[model samples]
Target: MSALPDSRYVSLTTFRRSGVAVPTPVWAAPDGGDLVVWTRADSGKVKRLRHTSRVTVAPCDVRGNLQGEAVEAQARLLPPGEWQPALAALARRYGWQWRITYGAGRLVGILRRRERRALIRISPA
Candidate 1:
Protein backbone atom coordinates (compact mmCIF):
# COMPACT_ATOMS: atom_id res chain seq x y z
CA MET A 1 0.00 0.00 0.00
CA SER A 2 1.06 3.57 -0.47
CA ALA A 3 1.89 5.79 2.48
CA LEU A 4 -1.71 6.82 3.02
CA PRO A 5 -2.16 7.35 6.73
CA ASP A 6 -4.81 5.66 8.85
CA SER A 7 -6.76 8.82 9.32
CA ARG A 8 -10.50 9.23 9.68
CA TYR A 9 -10.69 11.13 6.45
CA VAL A 10 -8.71 11.18 3.24
CA SER A 11 -8.17 14.13 0.96
CA LEU A 12 -9.09 12.79 -2.48
CA THR A 13 -7.93 15.05 -5.23
CA THR A 14 -9.20 14.78 -8.80
CA PHE A 15 -8.32 16.81 -11.81
CA ARG A 16 -10.39 18.58 -14.38
CA ARG A 17 -9.65 18.35 -18.09
CA SER A 18 -7.99 21.72 -17.79
CA GLY A 19 -5.66 20.20 -15.13
CA VAL A 20 -7.02 22.03 -12.12
CA ALA A 21 -7.13 19.81 -9.05
CA VAL A 22 -10.12 19.69 -6.72
CA PRO A 23 -9.79 18.07 -3.36
CA THR A 24 -12.47 16.68 -1.09
CA PRO A 25 -12.32 14.85 2.18
CA VAL A 26 -13.99 11.45 2.37
CA TRP A 27 -14.13 8.38 4.50
CA ALA A 28 -12.02 5.53 3.20
CA ALA A 29 -11.44 1.95 4.24
CA PRO A 30 -9.12 -0.78 3.08
CA ASP A 31 -10.72 -3.56 1.11
CA GLY A 32 -8.41 -6.35 -0.01
CA GLY A 33 -5.61 -4.58 -1.87
CA ASP A 34 -7.50 -1.39 -2.57
CA LEU A 35 -9.00 1.48 -0.64
CA VAL A 36 -12.74 1.89 -1.04
CA VAL A 37 -14.64 5.14 -0.75
CA TRP A 38 -18.37 5.78 -0.76
CA THR A 39 -19.87 8.80 -2.43
CA ARG A 40 -22.84 9.99 -4.41
CA ALA A 41 -22.94 8.77 -7.97
CA ASP A 42 -23.46 12.30 -9.19
CA SER A 43 -20.60 13.72 -7.16
CA GLY A 44 -17.93 15.76 -8.90
CA LYS A 45 -15.19 13.31 -7.94
CA VAL A 46 -17.06 10.46 -9.60
CA LYS A 47 -17.56 12.53 -12.71
CA ARG A 48 -13.87 13.36 -12.78
CA LEU A 49 -12.90 9.72 -12.44
CA ARG A 50 -14.97 8.91 -15.49
CA HIS A 51 -12.88 11.33 -17.44
CA THR A 52 -9.58 10.15 -15.95
CA SER A 53 -8.51 7.66 -13.32
CA ARG A 54 -5.57 9.74 -12.18
CA VAL A 55 -5.82 11.02 -8.64
CA THR A 56 -3.93 11.68 -5.43
CA VAL A 57 -4.78 10.66 -1.90
CA ALA A 58 -3.62 11.98 1.42
CA PRO A 59 -4.79 11.64 4.98
CA CYS A 60 -6.84 14.62 6.05
CA ASP A 61 -9.46 15.94 8.40
CA VAL A 62 -13.13 16.18 7.57
CA ARG A 63 -12.56 19.75 6.46
CA GLY A 64 -10.05 18.66 3.80
CA ASN A 65 -6.90 19.80 5.58
CA LEU A 66 -4.08 17.54 4.47
CA GLN A 67 -2.43 15.69 7.33
CA GLY A 68 -0.03 13.46 5.45
CA GLU A 69 1.97 13.18 2.26
CA ALA A 70 -0.07 12.76 -0.89
CA VAL A 71 0.34 9.63 -2.97
CA GLU A 72 -0.42 9.12 -6.64
CA ALA A 73 -3.19 6.62 -7.27
CA GLN A 74 -5.77 5.45 -9.76
CA ALA A 75 -9.43 5.56 -8.94
CA ARG A 76 -12.13 3.39 -10.48
CA LEU A 77 -15.84 3.87 -10.01
CA LEU A 78 -17.43 0.55 -9.18
CA PRO A 79 -20.60 -0.50 -10.96
CA PRO A 80 -23.79 -0.39 -8.93
CA GLY A 81 -23.96 -4.16 -8.65
CA GLU A 82 -20.51 -4.18 -7.04
CA TRP A 83 -21.27 -1.60 -4.37
CA GLN A 84 -21.96 -4.04 -1.55
CA PRO A 85 -18.38 -4.97 -0.86
CA ALA A 86 -17.33 -1.38 -0.64
CA LEU A 87 -20.22 -0.55 1.66
CA ALA A 88 -19.32 -3.54 3.83
CA ALA A 89 -15.75 -2.40 4.12
CA LEU A 90 -16.82 1.08 5.14
CA ALA A 91 -19.32 -0.25 7.64
CA ARG A 92 -16.63 -2.41 9.20
CA ARG A 93 -14.28 0.48 9.60
CA TYR A 94 -16.78 3.06 10.74
CA GLY A 95 -19.33 0.93 12.56
CA TRP A 96 -22.30 2.87 13.94
CA GLN A 97 -21.15 6.12 12.41
CA TRP A 98 -21.41 4.66 8.95
CA ARG A 99 -24.72 2.96 9.72
CA ILE A 100 -26.24 6.26 10.75
CA THR A 101 -24.95 8.02 7.70
CA TYR A 102 -26.13 5.23 5.42
CA GLY A 103 -29.54 5.12 7.01
CA ALA A 104 -29.99 8.85 6.85
CA GLY A 105 -28.98 8.97 3.21
CA ARG A 106 -31.34 6.14 2.37
CA LEU A 107 -34.18 7.84 4.15
CA VAL A 108 -33.52 11.09 2.36
CA GLY A 109 -33.37 9.33 -0.97
CA ILE A 110 -36.66 7.61 -0.34
CA LEU A 111 -38.24 10.95 0.44
CA ARG A 112 -36.68 12.57 -2.59
CA ARG A 113 -37.55 9.59 -4.82
CA ARG A 114 -34.00 9.25 -6.10
CA GLU A 115 -31.04 7.50 -4.56
CA ARG A 116 -27.74 6.82 -6.23
CA ARG A 117 -24.57 5.75 -4.47
CA ALA A 118 -21.11 5.28 -5.92
CA LEU A 119 -18.23 3.16 -4.77
CA ILE A 120 -14.71 4.15 -5.73
CA ARG A 121 -11.71 1.86 -5.49
CA ILE A 122 -8.30 3.48 -5.20
CA SER A 123 -5.22 1.53 -6.19
CA PRO A 124 -1.54 2.44 -6.06
CA ALA A 125 -0.39 3.90 -9.32
Candidate 2:
Protein backbone atom coordinates (compact mmCIF):
# COMPACT_ATOMS: atom_id res chain seq x y z
CA MET A 1 0.00 0.00 0.00
CA SER A 2 1.00 3.64 -0.45
CA ALA A 3 1.92 6.05 2.35
CA LEU A 4 -0.71 8.10 4.11
CA PRO A 5 -0.83 11.86 4.32
CA ASP A 6 1.42 13.56 6.85
CA SER A 7 -1.23 15.56 8.65
CA ARG A 8 -4.94 16.10 8.27
CA TYR A 9 -8.30 15.53 9.90
CA VAL A 10 -9.15 11.85 9.71
CA SER A 11 -12.00 9.52 10.43
CA LEU A 12 -11.02 7.26 13.31
CA THR A 13 -12.68 3.89 13.69
CA THR A 14 -12.70 2.01 16.96
CA PHE A 15 -14.66 -0.92 18.28
CA ARG A 16 -16.96 -0.41 21.21
CA ARG A 17 -18.66 -3.09 23.25
CA SER A 18 -22.02 -2.06 21.92
CA GLY A 19 -20.80 -1.86 18.33
CA VAL A 20 -18.38 0.09 16.19
CA ALA A 21 -18.13 3.82 16.65
CA VAL A 22 -16.68 5.94 13.89
CA PRO A 23 -15.50 9.37 15.04
CA THR A 24 -15.11 11.62 12.08
CA PRO A 25 -13.16 14.79 11.54
CA VAL A 26 -10.62 14.26 14.31
CA TRP A 27 -7.37 16.16 14.24
CA ALA A 28 -4.23 14.07 14.14
CA ALA A 29 -0.66 15.22 14.62
CA PRO A 30 2.55 13.72 13.34
CA ASP A 31 4.85 13.58 16.35
CA GLY A 32 7.91 11.55 17.16
CA GLY A 33 7.32 9.93 13.81
CA ASP A 34 3.87 8.82 14.88
CA LEU A 35 0.30 10.07 14.62
CA VAL A 36 -1.43 11.13 17.83
CA VAL A 37 -5.06 11.83 18.63
CA TRP A 38 -6.78 13.20 21.72
CA THR A 39 -10.22 12.38 23.08
CA ARG A 40 -12.19 12.41 26.31
CA ALA A 41 -10.82 9.94 28.83
CA ASP A 42 -14.27 8.60 29.40
CA SER A 43 -15.15 8.56 25.74
CA GLY A 44 -16.44 5.40 24.16
CA LYS A 45 -13.50 5.59 21.79
CA VAL A 46 -11.16 5.35 24.74
CA LYS A 47 -12.95 2.32 26.04
CA ARG A 48 -12.83 0.74 22.61
CA LEU A 49 -9.17 1.60 22.17
CA ARG A 50 -8.34 -0.21 25.39
CA HIS A 51 -9.53 -3.45 23.93
CA THR A 52 -7.96 -3.07 20.50
CA SER A 53 -5.10 -0.78 19.64
CA ARG A 54 -5.37 -1.23 15.92
CA VAL A 55 -7.08 1.67 14.17
CA THR A 56 -7.66 3.23 10.77
CA VAL A 57 -7.32 6.95 10.00
CA ALA A 58 -8.24 8.41 6.64
CA PRO A 59 -8.09 11.83 5.06
CA CYS A 60 -11.08 13.81 3.86
CA ASP A 61 -11.49 16.74 1.52
CA VAL A 62 -13.20 20.11 2.05
CA ARG A 63 -16.54 18.51 1.34
CA GLY A 64 -15.68 15.78 3.80
CA ASN A 65 -14.95 13.45 0.97
CA LEU A 66 -12.52 10.74 1.92
CA GLN A 67 -9.46 9.98 -0.20
CA GLY A 68 -5.99 8.45 0.01
CA GLU A 69 -4.78 5.42 1.88
CA ALA A 70 -6.47 4.69 5.20
CA VAL A 71 -3.61 4.29 7.65
CA GLU A 72 -3.47 1.24 9.83
CA ALA A 73 -1.52 1.84 13.02
CA GLN A 74 -1.03 0.75 16.59
CA ALA A 75 -2.56 2.95 19.26
CA ARG A 76 -1.60 3.55 22.86
CA LEU A 77 -2.88 5.84 25.58
CA LEU A 78 -0.56 8.73 26.28
CA PRO A 79 -0.30 10.59 29.54
CA PRO A 80 -1.94 14.02 29.41
CA GLY A 81 1.36 15.89 29.63
CA GLU A 82 3.04 13.70 27.05
CA TRP A 83 0.81 14.78 24.18
CA GLN A 84 -0.33 18.24 25.35
CA PRO A 85 2.44 20.19 23.65
CA ALA A 86 1.96 18.44 20.33
CA LEU A 87 -1.77 18.88 20.61
CA ALA A 88 -1.28 22.57 21.34
CA ALA A 89 0.98 22.93 18.33
CA LEU A 90 -1.60 21.28 16.11
CA ALA A 91 -4.33 23.57 17.47
CA ARG A 92 -2.22 26.60 16.67
CA ARG A 93 -1.43 25.32 13.20
CA TYR A 94 -5.07 24.59 12.48
CA GLY A 95 -6.24 27.84 14.11
CA TRP A 96 -8.20 25.89 16.64
CA GLN A 97 -9.41 27.58 19.85
CA TRP A 98 -7.62 25.40 22.35
CA ARG A 99 -4.46 27.47 22.87
CA ILE A 100 -6.28 30.24 24.71
CA THR A 101 -8.23 27.69 26.66
CA TYR A 102 -5.07 25.94 27.85
CA GLY A 103 -4.07 28.97 29.91
CA ALA A 104 -6.88 28.29 32.32
CA GLY A 105 -6.52 25.04 34.23
CA ARG A 106 -10.21 24.95 35.09
CA LEU A 107 -11.12 25.49 31.50
CA VAL A 108 -8.75 22.79 30.44
CA GLY A 109 -10.34 20.47 32.94
CA ILE A 110 -13.78 21.36 31.76
CA LEU A 111 -12.75 20.82 28.18
CA ARG A 112 -10.80 17.63 28.66
CA ARG A 113 -12.81 15.95 31.33
CA ARG A 114 -12.73 12.17 30.90
CA GLU A 115 -10.60 12.81 27.82
CA ARG A 116 -7.55 10.66 27.25
CA ARG A 117 -5.24 11.27 24.35
CA ALA A 118 -3.53 8.51 22.41
CA LEU A 119 -0.54 8.24 20.15
CA ILE A 120 -0.85 5.96 17.13
CA ARG A 121 2.51 4.69 16.01
CA ILE A 122 2.15 4.28 12.28
CA SER A 123 4.15 1.77 10.34
CA PRO A 124 3.70 -0.75 7.56
CA ALA A 125 1.15 -3.18 8.86
Candidate 3:
Protein backbone atom coordinates (compact mmCIF):
# COMPACT_ATOMS: atom_id res chain seq x y z
CA MET A 1 0.00 0.00 0.00
CA SER A 2 1.12 3.53 -0.57
CA ALA A 3 1.47 4.91 2.93
CA LEU A 4 0.63 8.55 2.33
CA PRO A 5 2.75 10.53 -0.11
CA ASP A 6 6.48 9.85 0.01
CA SER A 7 7.41 13.09 1.75
CA ARG A 8 4.32 13.85 3.76
CA TYR A 9 4.19 14.47 7.45
CA VAL A 10 1.86 11.71 8.67
CA SER A 11 -0.11 11.56 11.83
CA LEU A 12 0.78 8.20 13.27
CA THR A 13 -1.68 7.03 15.87
CA THR A 14 -0.55 4.23 18.14
CA PHE A 15 -2.94 2.62 20.53
CA ARG A 16 -2.88 2.32 24.28
CA ARG A 17 -3.89 -0.82 26.09
CA SER A 18 -7.28 0.68 26.73
CA GLY A 19 -7.75 1.35 23.01
CA VAL A 20 -7.21 5.06 23.16
CA ALA A 21 -5.02 6.35 20.38
CA VAL A 22 -2.12 8.69 20.81
CA PRO A 23 -1.13 10.55 17.71
CA THR A 24 2.06 12.23 16.68
CA PRO A 25 3.13 13.89 13.49
CA VAL A 26 6.10 12.29 11.77
CA TRP A 27 8.01 12.64 8.57
CA ALA A 28 7.76 9.51 6.44
CA ALA A 29 9.16 8.23 3.19
CA PRO A 30 8.23 5.35 0.96
CA ASP A 31 10.43 2.29 1.45
CA GLY A 32 9.73 -0.33 -1.14
CA GLY A 33 6.24 -1.61 -0.30
CA ASP A 34 6.29 -0.04 3.14
CA LEU A 35 6.89 3.36 4.65
CA VAL A 36 9.80 4.18 6.93
CA VAL A 37 10.06 6.60 9.80
CA TRP A 38 12.59 7.42 12.47
CA THR A 39 11.66 8.55 15.94
CA ARG A 40 13.04 8.76 19.44
CA ALA A 41 13.36 5.26 20.85
CA ASP A 42 11.68 6.15 24.09
CA SER A 43 8.72 7.90 22.55
CA GLY A 44 5.17 6.85 23.28
CA LYS A 45 4.65 5.69 19.71
CA VAL A 46 7.57 3.30 19.93
CA LYS A 47 6.44 2.03 23.28
CA ARG A 48 2.97 1.39 21.95
CA LEU A 49 4.26 -0.30 18.80
CA ARG A 50 6.18 -2.68 20.98
CA HIS A 51 2.96 -3.75 22.60
CA THR A 52 0.89 -3.88 19.44
CA SER A 53 1.37 -3.42 15.72
CA ARG A 54 -2.00 -1.72 15.33
CA VAL A 55 -1.64 1.82 14.04
CA THR A 56 -3.32 4.31 11.78
CA VAL A 57 -1.70 6.92 9.60
CA ALA A 58 -2.88 9.90 7.62
CA PRO A 59 -1.50 12.94 5.89
CA CYS A 60 -0.97 15.71 8.40
CA ASP A 61 0.80 18.96 9.03
CA VAL A 62 3.77 19.42 11.35
CA ARG A 63 1.65 19.87 14.44
CA GLY A 64 0.02 16.40 14.35
CA ASN A 65 -3.20 17.82 13.00
CA LEU A 66 -4.90 15.48 10.59
CA GLN A 67 -5.49 16.49 7.01
CA GLY A 68 -6.97 13.25 5.81
CA GLU A 69 -8.69 10.10 6.96
CA ALA A 70 -6.54 7.58 8.82
CA VAL A 71 -5.81 4.22 7.27
CA GLU A 72 -5.08 1.02 9.12
CA ALA A 73 -1.46 -0.05 9.19
CA GLN A 74 0.94 -2.21 11.11
CA ALA A 75 4.38 -1.12 12.22
CA ARG A 76 7.57 -2.82 13.24
CA LEU A 77 10.91 -1.59 14.39
CA LEU A 78 13.42 -2.25 11.67
CA PRO A 79 16.62 -4.16 12.28
CA PRO A 80 19.71 -2.16 13.13
CA GLY A 81 21.33 -3.07 9.82
CA GLU A 82 18.71 -1.03 7.97
CA TRP A 83 18.82 2.13 10.07
CA GLN A 84 21.30 4.01 7.90
CA PRO A 85 19.60 2.94 4.69
CA ALA A 86 16.21 4.01 6.01
CA LEU A 87 17.63 7.39 6.98
CA ALA A 88 19.18 7.69 3.53
CA ALA A 89 15.81 7.04 1.95
CA LEU A 90 14.28 9.77 4.08
CA ALA A 91 17.00 12.21 3.05
CA ARG A 92 16.49 11.39 -0.61
CA ARG A 93 12.78 12.06 -0.31
CA TYR A 94 12.95 15.11 1.89
CA GLY A 95 16.24 16.62 0.69
CA TRP A 96 18.56 18.90 2.65
CA GLN A 97 15.96 19.91 5.20
CA TRP A 98 15.64 16.35 6.46
CA ARG A 99 19.39 15.87 6.37
CA ILE A 100 19.92 18.91 8.54
CA THR A 101 17.14 18.20 10.98
CA TYR A 102 17.81 14.49 11.30
CA GLY A 103 21.51 15.11 11.70
CA ALA A 104 20.89 17.64 14.41
CA GLY A 105 18.44 15.37 16.17
CA ARG A 106 21.06 12.66 16.30
CA LEU A 107 23.62 15.10 17.64
CA VAL A 108 21.25 16.34 20.31
CA GLY A 109 20.39 12.78 21.24
CA ILE A 110 24.04 12.03 21.80
CA LEU A 111 24.65 15.15 23.82
CA ARG A 112 21.64 14.53 26.00
CA ARG A 113 22.49 10.86 26.51
CA ARG A 114 18.96 10.10 25.32
CA GLU A 115 18.07 6.68 24.07
CA ARG A 116 19.10 6.32 20.46
CA ARG A 117 16.21 6.82 18.06
CA ALA A 118 14.60 3.91 16.21
CA LEU A 119 13.76 3.29 12.59
CA ILE A 120 10.42 1.69 11.79
CA ARG A 121 8.74 0.20 8.78
CA ILE A 122 5.00 0.44 8.29
CA SER A 123 2.89 -1.68 5.99
CA PRO A 124 -0.79 -1.96 5.20
CA ALA A 125 -2.68 -4.06 7.67
Candidate 4:
Protein backbone atom coordinates (compact mmCIF):
# COMPACT_ATOMS: atom_id res chain seq x y z
CA MET A 1 0.00 0.00 0.00
CA SER A 2 1.26 3.44 -0.90
CA ALA A 3 0.39 4.87 2.49
CA LEU A 4 3.70 6.46 3.40
CA PRO A 5 4.16 10.11 2.53
CA ASP A 6 7.14 11.76 0.87
CA SER A 7 7.79 14.04 3.80
CA ARG A 8 11.01 13.89 5.77
CA TYR A 9 9.26 13.32 9.05
CA VAL A 10 6.32 11.17 10.09
CA SER A 11 4.32 11.10 13.29
CA LEU A 12 4.11 7.49 14.43
CA THR A 13 1.22 6.89 16.79
CA THR A 14 1.51 3.87 19.03
CA PHE A 15 -1.11 2.81 21.51
CA ARG A 16 -0.84 2.26 25.23
CA ARG A 17 -2.45 -0.63 27.07
CA SER A 18 -5.35 1.64 27.99
CA GLY A 19 -5.81 2.35 24.24
CA VAL A 20 -4.57 5.92 24.45
CA ALA A 21 -2.52 6.91 21.44
CA VAL A 22 0.96 8.35 21.88
CA PRO A 23 2.52 10.11 18.93
CA THR A 24 6.18 10.69 18.29
CA PRO A 25 7.86 12.33 15.30
CA VAL A 26 10.42 10.21 13.55
CA TRP A 27 12.40 10.04 10.33
CA ALA A 28 11.06 7.56 7.81
CA ALA A 29 11.79 6.44 4.26
CA PRO A 30 9.92 4.39 1.72
CA ASP A 31 11.36 0.89 1.48
CA GLY A 32 9.73 -1.26 -1.20
CA GLY A 33 6.08 -1.73 -0.23
CA ASP A 34 6.80 -0.69 3.36
CA LEU A 35 8.32 2.20 5.25
CA VAL A 36 11.44 1.97 7.36
CA VAL A 37 12.00 4.02 10.50
CA TRP A 38 15.07 4.53 12.61
CA THR A 39 14.59 4.74 16.34
CA ARG A 40 15.96 3.81 19.72
CA ALA A 41 15.74 0.16 20.67
CA ASP A 42 14.27 0.92 24.09
CA SER A 43 11.94 3.71 23.03
CA GLY A 44 8.36 3.74 24.25
CA LYS A 45 7.07 3.26 20.69
CA VAL A 46 9.20 0.18 20.25
CA LYS A 47 8.08 -1.11 23.61
CA ARG A 48 4.46 -0.57 22.64
CA LEU A 49 4.99 -2.32 19.29
CA ARG A 50 6.27 -5.34 21.11
CA HIS A 51 2.87 -5.73 22.70
CA THR A 52 0.84 -4.60 19.70
CA SER A 53 1.88 -4.05 16.11
CA ARG A 54 -0.96 -1.67 15.45
CA VAL A 55 -0.02 1.95 14.67
CA THR A 56 -0.91 4.96 12.62
CA VAL A 57 1.40 7.26 10.68
CA ALA A 58 1.12 10.64 9.04
CA PRO A 59 3.37 13.11 7.35
CA CYS A 60 4.56 15.72 9.82
CA ASP A 61 7.12 18.40 10.37
CA VAL A 62 10.23 17.90 12.42
CA ARG A 63 8.35 19.31 15.40
CA GLY A 64 5.53 16.73 14.99
CA ASN A 65 2.90 18.97 13.44
CA LEU A 66 0.78 16.79 11.20
CA GLN A 67 0.68 17.82 7.55
CA GLY A 68 -1.43 15.03 6.19
CA GLU A 69 -4.00 12.38 7.03
CA ALA A 70 -3.08 9.47 9.24
CA VAL A 71 -2.97 5.96 7.84
CA GLU A 72 -3.44 2.80 9.89
CA ALA A 73 -0.51 0.41 9.78
CA GLN A 74 1.34 -2.38 11.52
CA ALA A 75 4.87 -2.06 12.80
CA ARG A 76 7.53 -4.56 13.74
CA LEU A 77 10.91 -4.12 15.37
CA LEU A 78 13.38 -5.64 12.92
CA PRO A 79 16.00 -8.06 14.12
CA PRO A 80 19.44 -6.62 14.79
CA GLY A 81 20.95 -8.51 11.86
CA GLU A 82 18.37 -7.03 9.51
CA TRP A 83 19.05 -3.41 10.36
CA GLN A 84 21.40 -2.72 7.48
CA PRO A 85 18.74 -2.06 4.86
CA ALA A 86 16.80 0.18 7.22
CA LEU A 87 19.94 2.18 7.98
CA ALA A 88 20.72 2.38 4.28
CA ALA A 89 17.26 3.66 3.46
CA LEU A 90 17.50 6.37 6.09
CA ALA A 91 20.98 7.29 4.95
CA ARG A 92 19.77 7.63 1.38
CA ARG A 93 16.93 9.84 2.45
CA TYR A 94 18.81 12.04 4.95
CA GLY A 95 22.29 12.00 3.38
CA TRP A 96 25.06 13.59 5.42
CA GLN A 97 22.66 14.62 8.14
CA TRP A 98 21.86 10.98 8.82
CA ARG A 99 25.53 10.12 8.85
CA ILE A 100 26.23 12.73 11.49
CA THR A 101 23.26 11.73 13.59
CA TYR A 102 24.08 8.03 13.32
CA GLY A 103 27.68 8.66 14.29
CA ALA A 104 26.73 10.71 17.31
CA GLY A 105 24.12 8.19 18.37
CA ARG A 106 26.60 5.33 18.05
CA LEU A 107 29.16 7.18 20.16
CA VAL A 108 26.55 7.87 22.79
CA GLY A 109 25.42 4.27 22.69
CA ILE A 110 28.94 3.12 23.31
CA LEU A 111 29.55 5.52 26.17
CA ARG A 112 26.20 4.71 27.71
CA ARG A 113 26.52 0.96 27.11
CA ARG A 114 23.16 0.71 25.46
CA GLU A 115 21.95 -0.82 22.23
CA ARG A 116 20.92 2.60 20.99
CA ARG A 117 19.59 2.05 17.50
CA ALA A 118 16.73 -0.05 16.18
CA LEU A 119 14.70 -0.32 12.98
CA ILE A 120 10.95 -0.44 12.60
CA ARG A 121 9.22 -1.76 9.53
CA ILE A 122 5.78 -0.31 8.90
CA SER A 123 3.25 -1.66 6.46
CA PRO A 124 -0.29 -0.61 5.63
CA ALA A 125 -2.83 -2.51 7.67
RMSD of each: 1.4, 3.9, 2.0, 1.2
Sorted on TM-score, highest at the top, how do the candidates line up? Answer: 4, 1, 3, 2
lDDT of the structure predicted as candidate 4: 0.91
lDDT of the candidates, in the order given: 0.89, 0.60, 0.85, 0.91
Give the per-residue lDDT digits (tens) of candidate 1, residues 31-121. 8877899898899999999999999999999899998899999999888798889899999999999999999988988898996677899
Reference-based lDDT, residue 2, model 4: 47
Model 3: residues with Cα > 4 Å off, grouped in runs: 1-7, 112-115
Clashing pairs in 1: none
Per-residue lDDT of model 4, residues 2-72, tens digit only? 46676899999999999999999999988887889988888899889989999999999999999999999
Mind giving the per-residue lDDT tens digits that candidate 2 earns over 2-72?
45456567666665666665645566656656666655566766777788776776786644467766777
What TM value does model 3 have? 0.87
CA deviation > 4 Å runs, candidate 1:
1-3
Q: How accurate is candidate 3 locally (lDDT)?
A: 0.85
**Poorest lDDT segment (10 consecutive residues) of candidate 3:** 1-10
